[model samples]
Target: MTYFNDFDINENIKKAIKEMGFEEPSPIQEKAIPEILSGRDLIGQAQTGTGKTAAFGIPLINQITTAPHVQTIILTPTRELAIQVSGELQKLSKYMKIRTLPIYGGQSIGHQIRALKQGVQIVIGTPGRIQDHLRRKTLRLDKVRAVVLDEADEMLDMGFIDDIENILKQVNTDRKTLLFSATMPPAIRKLSRRYMNSPVTVSINKSEVTAPSIDQVYFKVLERNKQESLCRILDSKDPELGIIFCRTKKGVAELTEALQARGYLADGLHGDLTQSQRDAVMKKFRDSSIEFLVATDVAARGIDVNDVSHVINYDIPQDPESYVHRIGRTGRAGKSGEALTLVTPREMKHLRSIEAEIKMAIPSHAVPSIEEVVEKQQQSWKNLITDQLNDDEDLSLFNALTEELLEQYEAKDIVRSLMKLNFSSAIGESDDGYNFGETGGAKGMIRFFINVGRNVNMSPKVLIEEISNAVGIPGKAVGRIDIFENFTFVEVPEDVAPFVYEALRYSRINGARVNLEPAKPRPKRENRPRPARPSR
Candidate 1:
């Protein structure tokens, strides 16, 4: 959980990371940033989405000065990756007077030459285009501090290895060399061994199975309760930017509407949206105009926003890979992040399967109470006030009023009163709000009382068989079944309870007509007569 603030970096870089909304460093960033900043040549083995860009980019931005000359060159495989890398660098160097130019094949070479002559501080481009500049004698690496081979494997596979070597040969001395690749194939390794100086290798497994900086948790909730659960989490967490992943386009639309109805700055992205509509929504999300983005997996493919503080899986992902990809969207840019999932009882097994795939256990949490949400909101208010006071430097303007108030009232009482005034909606909220009422049984189960039990030769097996047949579900779908002489308590999945109740109520089970309904807490003691013991 290394934060960007923990780094021995300058205020300009710190301000840039903050503006980009990175709260904690990703695992790669945590392991690699320090090594890179210490002036060590490093080899990073990580996948594309593992925040490798910032892992290398942050250190480069921190070390490079505004001396009006290029200090680093990042070589990527494609024009797309080159442009993407350049965009991320610009964001990281926003507070510094640093310039980054993306030179690639499709773009005008003359334009790149012009930007280069104007003294770009960092240049990211495909190896081929960089070679073009070198051939034209328009690019100079004499003063470069570092050479980053980003996606080294991809560049090699795209036949840029020769060009990469030629370009690296120019700045082979007195410079740091960072090589990042998803896989260390023989060719890339040979090149690393040839060019790099005793590099310290930091490997964040190529699959990126886990986002170590993102806190992962789940809520066992019913299908109907998911939207409200998400809303409550949003209130409690108050993320700066969030992405809620749904399993379908319809789910995205519905969740987006629900959030928007509750006054969240939300928009939806799905297969149904036109490209223009999606671009608009993404623009809003990136610019902080929209606080949340509700999206389906396919629609969220190219999303690379760095400031997403939270990733909420409104529906649990279908597989472990999707889960990893979804949560990886947060906790980037050296910022701590949160990942929340809502799973129905029936989906718990699937969730467990995903957990097994990722080789990690996801802890379950009870839904936040309205009281907790209010407390979080009040804490946010406290932080807001504290930041204002700290930044003001001249709080003497309010010293007289504070002293007078302290004289009239106790400090705790005065602060509490002020908090109440500042956040009336939160202070006035009733603690009894959002009582979903005795969830019938455990997290994802609903308990039901069936009037016929042991008296009619009823047993767990018989009850399971009858219920499964009646409800068209598997026998294993029923949870715990407790047989009493006259009535039995049965537990079933939450979303299926209504169907079970409808199918079994006033219906014959084991030759006796039975009544069934959702049970209250099991009776302490029953003082009723037992019915005749009958056979099925």
Candidate 2:
């Protein structure tokens, strides 16, 4: 489909697309939307950047009616993604009358239940929270016209296969099933075969996965130095329009606040923000009022801009496909763009995996030193002066002061003094004054204490292997592992700590369920009772 109007979609959908600034369908949307509209089971193999959410959202919303029972439900792997899908559906159903609600774990269940009782037509949620509603009989799925498994592979990786099976079984057998994922692993394939009815697969070729116009590179920096390195890169690139991608909502908020405190024109977007708040932030970003937009992967999916010169990954993307999506925000509409990733020493292995899967060798580069950054800024400063001189603006207001200063000091000295005034505020912005707060571990690591150890046959090797398999992260990313007689202390990357926690909270180790929590500060040795000395 060349244009959204070319397809046999609802008039309201076309109107919403126009309002949302999209005139045409992406490759994935072009293929998937028609099949979905035809009421057949669909298996869409496309990443986030290809507009897969809208691909399914358009048809799903088009078919669903404002019924008393839920007519459509979308299952996403993360809370943020669930909210993103709900927001996208809200836009697509703007001209129509429909109610969409996103239910996830952190929010109060009573609030969700109250909203559910008000008769919502569409529900989007994470698997765990959806399961809670299912157990409570709050979600009515008997009238469901369609079911969408957004990011199927991500759900499988997060150990939600059983939950998915349970939820699918509750929906009526005649409903359409749609599964969208970046890759079709064996588990996801098995799932589709068992649950779907003659599903048609839509995939974008490898060549279309990423653009060649993007100049990609990676930098190895300690976790403590990530913000500092990002600042240096920002000063060096001076992108006209830039977006910084972070993985978690907390990361987005924290990074946005940090950049703002440092005098950068930056704002953040995440699921936590209200719709009006998101609109304000995006409006600022589009009109160039904000130079850098710090956002998560899903939150930035709908961002369509042509002049974005750079995309910085403050926290490395978890997958190659997500890397493609993150960088795709830039390099739009035939303009060249640059992308940079910051990796910790332990994350280099994961970075290599992304490189191998993406089939591109992201060259390594050192973070610009303070001296190098200053030199580049000095050149830029000179260019600014040249441009000002070319503008032919009158300088009579400052002429008398310049003359007085010129009489007191050499002309070169006068210029140097101006330089000092310009650069003094920004000097050594991160040298010793930077705050890298303690995260219960060494820099870049968050130490977690699991309530299972040698008592349940746990060992360092077993712990590392089990965690790696459970969370889909490299064993190296699991930092130092120390197994005690009854408990264990393990360190993991700060960025990945949440995933580990979520994946392992209800998980079993050595055939016994385990509990995981952040390690509290160890008390002074004297605060503990002295152990009895064993007889020699």
Q: Which ten residues in a row have the lowest lDDT in candidate 2?
A: 430-439
Question: Could you tell me the TM-score of candidate 2?
Answer: 0.59
Candidates' lDDT values, in order?
Answer: 0.80, 0.81
TM-score per prediction, in order, is 0.49, 0.59
Which residue pairs in model 2 clash with each other? none
lDDT of 1 by residue, 1-536 (tens): 57889999888888988887778887789999999989999999876578789999998998888898889999887655776888999988888899999997766899989988999989998888888898899999999989999878767766788898899888738999999986678999999899988999998752353556789998765454567667777787788999999999988888888777667899999878765677689889989999999998767754777799999998888776568768878876567899999876556667878778777888878768767777777667778898987794766788899999999999999977887776654333343212324635777888887877777889988888777655446898888877878788888887667556656666787788889877776455855455455568
* Residue 82, model 2: Cα distance from true site in angstroms: 3.0
Q: After superposition, how far is residue 209 of candidate 1 from its true place, in Å?
A: 7.2
